[model samples]
Target: MPQPSSARLHEFRIVSNDKIAQDIFSLVIEAPQLAKTIKPGQFMNFEVPGNAMSLLRIPLSFARADADAGTVEIWYAVVGDGTERLSRMKPGDTSTVLGPGGKGWGVPAECSRALLVGGGIGVPPLVPLAAELARAGIPFDVCLGAKTASELVGESELDALGAQTLSVATDDGTEGHCGFVTDLAAELLQQGGYDYVATCGPGVMMQKVAEAALAAGAYCEASLERMMSCGFGACSTCNVETTEGMKGACMCGPVFDASKVVVW
Candidate 1:
């Protein structure tokens, strides 16, 4: 069995909160201890403030972490009551968080070039992964897509990282490329040279990316975003169909080998 997040519950104070695009928002939290241990691809279960109706905590992937300043960041879209309440919170408000949950991406030490792909809200987690790769001196590129330009976030941030290449796609034809991000992935794969691929997004997008990666003979992994009531394996709502049978995404992975998962 894959390991679980630490049992420790962290009380984090909201340091900064701002709406970046549309209903999307960015949150920087003060959690000195948790920041040090948090890893890329891991998620945090936030105790939503004033959410009396919804008993479940909100799970968000770490967008960035600053160990030096003792801060952890997350990006979210206001889709429901829980997130609506979170957006109303002030800087000094405090919330409980249980995290660095689930298995994460392993940096490809042997690969010279890697591709990181993210779509819409899925873009957040890839930010930290890019940072980690940069620190490890792994050359990489980023491919980001969204339904529309307004829903997109983090292009400039990824560009600022000095990635080898950057590609963007939008369904509306308002930016970089028109049509699906998977189309872009297919094009990049045809060009070759990327030995590794990591992606997170809608299921359809990920499935296409996986197929392209396999055809290109590149190793690939994906982060699944399922309905997880509990950030741990107890709830069983996050089980994924894999070659090894059903596995708890919260415990085994939000990250999984792209080829091993049943994407249909």
Candidate 2:
């Protein structure tokens, strides 16, 4: 596991807010200090003050990070009123950004190759992770899944990153493979060169991916999404059952060893 984030509060100016996919929008925030320390699979808690309905800070992971530009991007689907309100804010608007929170995914030094699996809204976090892999000279392949072609927003981004290979699976046959991304990843893992597998998405999807990795005798880690009232570990709302006992997703993880998580 990676070290816990050095959480801080900074007022960030919204740099850009643009629609990336069907219902998903990418929100870029300017926070030099926070941007420098953020890593893949890590998320920030935003305090959007204008709405009476948004009483708590919303958690969003880094879709991309530009430490040089002093900015980090979050890809969020407008699933609720909180995200809807965030989508309406202009580029010059400011919001309280508290972060560099949660444990992030890490690839072991011994591992030279990795497979990244993501689904639906869960696909955003994998972008930074894949970039890091590319930067480190550790070759990787990405397998993303969505209900249809329109929802695969990160495909172009991943293509631009020039990963070793890119694969997509949609529920309908509008894209690459017509199946779950886990199935694609499983097929690749079975080919036998990958050293590790990292995934994030729906709980059920991750569970199946975990099983496949384990069956193939490969190492695997998963980033989990849970309802969080407080971005820090103060509130126990984001607890997850693990092999050791109960662990808080806000602190202990949003990422964990696939073998440890007791997925239903």
Candidate 3:
């Protein structure tokens, strides 16, 4: 786990901010030091301008980090006031950010095969993990889910990263399998070659993925989303109930051993 001291506040400038899907935006920022240090599942808290009254920064996970280009790419859904403000920021807008927060994925040394499951906006963090797996010569598969075809993101990017098999499920039957992504995940887990599984999504979706991974005898890690009022551990707003006890997401995790988590 990364300590509060390891996470630094850096000045960042928006390189590009574009609407990629319905109510979803892809934001690229120039944060050279952050781009170089951020890990696959680590998150950043951005100080969006124009919200003078709102004190909380928007916490987001990056989809990609290009160290050579000194850029970090984030994919986020415009769900609230902060994000709505973030969506409006033009290129060249400048702000400050706190990152690389918390621990990232802990892929086992013997992991030869892996499975990644994501749903809705939760897909962003998994994208970089897929790239890491590919670079390590680990063949993996992906299962993605969205409410509708227009809401889905990251399939193309994951495919580009060489996922052995990419499957999708949409609630409305507007895309791939007409059901929960858990259906695809369960089927894949049953095939039995994966040694590790990583998932991020709605609580219910991640819980299901965790169950399936456990039954398949694979080690599973999940990135949990919580209300992080403070980017650091001071606020205690992002506490997650684990078997060990309650731990703050901003410091102890956004990622945790699936089996150790008590509450979804």
Cα RMSDs, all models: 1.1, 1.5, 1.0
TM-score, structure 3 vs. true: 0.98
Q: Per-residue alpha-carbon lDDT of model 3 for 1-264, expressed as tens digits?
A: 336546889999999999999999999999999999999999999998897799888899999999999999999999989999999999999999999998889999999899999999999999999999999999999999999999999999999999999999999999999999999999999989999999999999999999999999999999999999987888889999999889898888899999999999
| Best prediction by TM-score | 3
Per-residue lDDT for 131-190 in model 1, tens only? 988988888988899999999998999988878889999999989899888888899988
By summed lDDT, which 10 consecutive residues of candidate 3 come out lowest? 1-10
Q: What is residue 10's positional error in candidate 1, in angstroms?
A: 0.2
Q: What are the models' TM-scores?
A: 0.97, 0.96, 0.98
Give the per-residue lDDT digits (tens) of candidate 2, residues 1-264. 425557899889999999988999999999999889988988899887677765898899988988999998999999887888899988999878889898888788888788889999998888998888888888888899999998887888888877789999999979999988888988998888877889989999999888888887778989999899997878889998899888888888898888999853
Clash tally for model 1: 0
- Comparing 1 with 3 on TM-score, the higher-scoring candidate is 3
Stretches of candidate 1 off by over 4 Å are none
- Candidate 3 differs from the real structure by a C-alpha RMSD in angstroms, to one decimal, of 1.0
